[model samples]
Target chain A: MEQYFVNKVIENNRFVIEDSETFKHVAKVLRHKPGDVIYLVDPEQNLFTATIERITDDKIETSVNKLATPSTELPIDVTIACSLSKKDKIEWITQKSTELGAKKIIFFSSKYSIMTWKKNVIEKKLIRLQEIAKNAAQQSKRRIVPQVVYVNKLTDLVDHKAQSNLVAYEESAKQGEISLLAQTLNQNPNSILCAFGPEGGFAPDEINFLNKSDFLSVGLGPRIMRAETAPMYFLSVLSYKYELTVK
Target chain B: MEQYFVNKVIENNRFVIEDSETFKHVAKVLRHKPGDVIYLVDPEQNLFTATIERITDDKIETSVNKLATPSTELPIDVTIACSLSKKDKIEWITQKSTELGAKKIIFFSSKYSIMTWKKNVIEKKLIRLQEIAKNAAQQSKRRIVPQVVYVNKLTDLVDHKAQSNLVAYEESAKQGEISLLAQTLNQNPNSILCAFGPEGGFAPDEINFLNKSDFLSVGLGPRIMRAETAPMYFLSVLSYKYELTVK
Candidate 1:
């Protein structure tokens, strides 16, 4: 079934979706005639099964049949704090990370980051990234679109109230460290923060700062992964260990 | 350090590379001056630390320093047989799957694969994808480039001799089944062949053919993934398990 995110409240037997853009998409683009079935998520985050009752140029109305169960959200909140890359790579990070069930994506311009987003370009760039997140969310049937944020430096990564914080480093792989991913699944931590580096990678001082902040240094594997692809690897492993393996 | 794949036989403390392309890459494109370091692999599949000794338009020569130990390739060779997608997505899969250590990539047209290569165009298309795999191999520093092969039908796939064969199905996800990825570590299968559907996914009869051919049905998760993205997920999970966790 085609799913749409609707900004409305689902009451006893009706959904009131009044967002103009969504109304236009549902009524005009979709060409959803009356009595056609569609899935909608209301403002309260309830997924409602509804049949189109009326189609108009302004608003398309649907009668709520029942609330759908089985939300596709990850069991634990995961916040991937990755160093910013060039525009296309960052967009890829946002899209794939959302599909793998990231709860938040925080970007920091690292000491060795080659690409810089000027202050003037920040707003429009963020809006574009957010659109990528929205489309990924809808495609993956995610209840929430992960938030995208930006930071200027290492110190800008303030301590969040996460149950665990990890930094994936190439050095750890050289040392043959076992994966911390499988071990971090205890009670499915309230929130997990994973940080990745940019092209030139984190400077030695940045690693020192992260070490001081009690971030566990772990290894993904032996072969080197590109900057944009590494964090997605981390999230996939984490998701596999926690979400897929558990009974 | 930059790495390049070289085919040479080290004899009497010297190395000779006969491939004309590699000669041009080293002596021409890289503009090697004597005493520069390059990682080379000999015909015995052994990694060698070679220092540039001579540079010529036809042949660049290097003196062998010592036998370098290559990281043991993944114990289980994994081959991903999937339908080709849009150019970028297919390139993404080829690059990332190489990093994840996939051994071979095969593509076949399905009922709904968006892109199609006709008989006249097959060789050129294969060459293009092979170049992708070669660049990916160089980027990830793999000992060999994964082969890119084209096969046209399910019957062609049934002739493979991998120890394990499987296919990812969204219907399995709908049924709340665990992924075949979870079996990677426990089973320690010697080689794996995994097939993924095209954009519209496998028709019911196609799924039945795979089932009848003894391909295990695996589910990724609740959320749907693009066909190209799905195999990378499988390989990433495999790396997490075998490369990081098991050893």
Candidate 2:
């Protein structure tokens, strides 16, 4: 069954989709006519099995059967605060991270970051990234679509509070500082904020600031991952530790 | 410091670079002069800090200063046997998996695989992937560059023996089969062979074959990952379990 994210709320066990894009995708592209079954994911991440009842010129009416139980979301909320890299790499990271169960993604400018988001076109870029996240979420059967946020500086992440904070620092791996992330996740924090650097990595001042702010510097492994590969690795390890390792 | 993988072996504390690509990169791109230091990783995965002694028209001579310890290779060997995906995705997998410490990558044809490799061009493609692995290994400062191998079918992997074998099955994930991968890794298998499907996933027959061959069907997480992302996730999880989480 095909799945589509809708913006409307279900009322009296029925909901009408008025969005032109989704309507076209269902009624035109997928050719989902009356009596066809499809899944509708609401804003709250609740999935419903819906059967198409009627179709109008600009809208589609579907009868909600029941709520589905299986969730594709991770047990713990993970927010990736990564330094904005080159254009293609950032988009790739957004798509892959969404598939790996990231709850939120924030791209910020670091001391060594090369790309800077322009003020006037930042909204456009955000929209593109959000679309990528949505497509990836649907393809991966994720319950929630991750939000993509852009910030001007690393300090911007300080305002976004989480139960735990970590920075993917390569120096820690060089010094063989292992088990920090595992130990932190073992506490079962409701949410986690992980920060990654750009091509040149975080500057000394940035590391000091993160350290002072109680952000534990964690290492992915001994190998030096590219800027785009770090967050995906972080999410994968999180999934393995929190989801796969648990019985 | 920049690192390069050389084919020559060190003899009497000196080695001459003969490979055209490495020679050009060292002499033309880096513009290294006499007495400049560079790190060379040999075929044996040994890292040597060398000083440039002389630069001739054909080759550059360097005297080995000392050997470096603390390798970046994983404790256990991991081979990713992925169904041949699109050109870019397979290349991306090779590069990222190399950075994540995969010892070998084998691309084989699956029942649902979209792209098929031609026999005449397969060797060339393997060389290209090998070059990508080499570059990634150098960038990640890995001790060994992963070998890229090509095969015809899933059963071909039966010839490539490993202590542990796993297949990333989405159905297993949907069925909520967790802890299998962690349990297998906890046994500390000296080598592992993990296989991933193409976009459409494995055919039923392939799954049956894997099951009969004692390849455990493993779930990555609740979310579905792309073909390229699965191997990277597997390697990341392996690194976390065997390397990072170790005290």
iRMS values for every prediction = 1.7, 0.9
Runs in model 2 lying further than 4 Å from the true structure: none
User: What TM-score does model 1 achieve against the real structure?
Assistant: 0.95
CAPRI docking class of candidate 2: high
The top-ranked prediction according to DockQ is 2
Q: What is the TM-score of chain A in candidate 2?
A: 0.95
**Candidate 1 chain A worst ten-residue window by lDDT:** A178-187
Candidate 1 structure quality by residue, lDDT tens digits, B33-152: 889988875555566777888877687677876555547467679999887678787777888888878999888878778887779988987888888887777777677788888888
Each candidate's DockQ: 0.63, 0.85
Which digits, one per residue and each the tens of the lDDT, describe model 2 over residues A134-229?
989988888789999998878878887589999999999888888898899889999999999998999999999998998999988888899998
Q: Among the candidates, what TM-score does chain A have in each? A: 0.93, 0.95
- Candidate 1 at residue B155, lDDT? 57
Model 1 alpha-carbon drift over 4 Å, by segment: A186-188, B68-72
- How many residue pairs collide in each prediction? 0, 0
TM-score of each: 0.95, 0.97
Candidate 2: tens digits of C-alpha lDDT, residues B119-216: 89999999999999999999999988899999988898888758999999999988888889989998999999999999899999999999889899
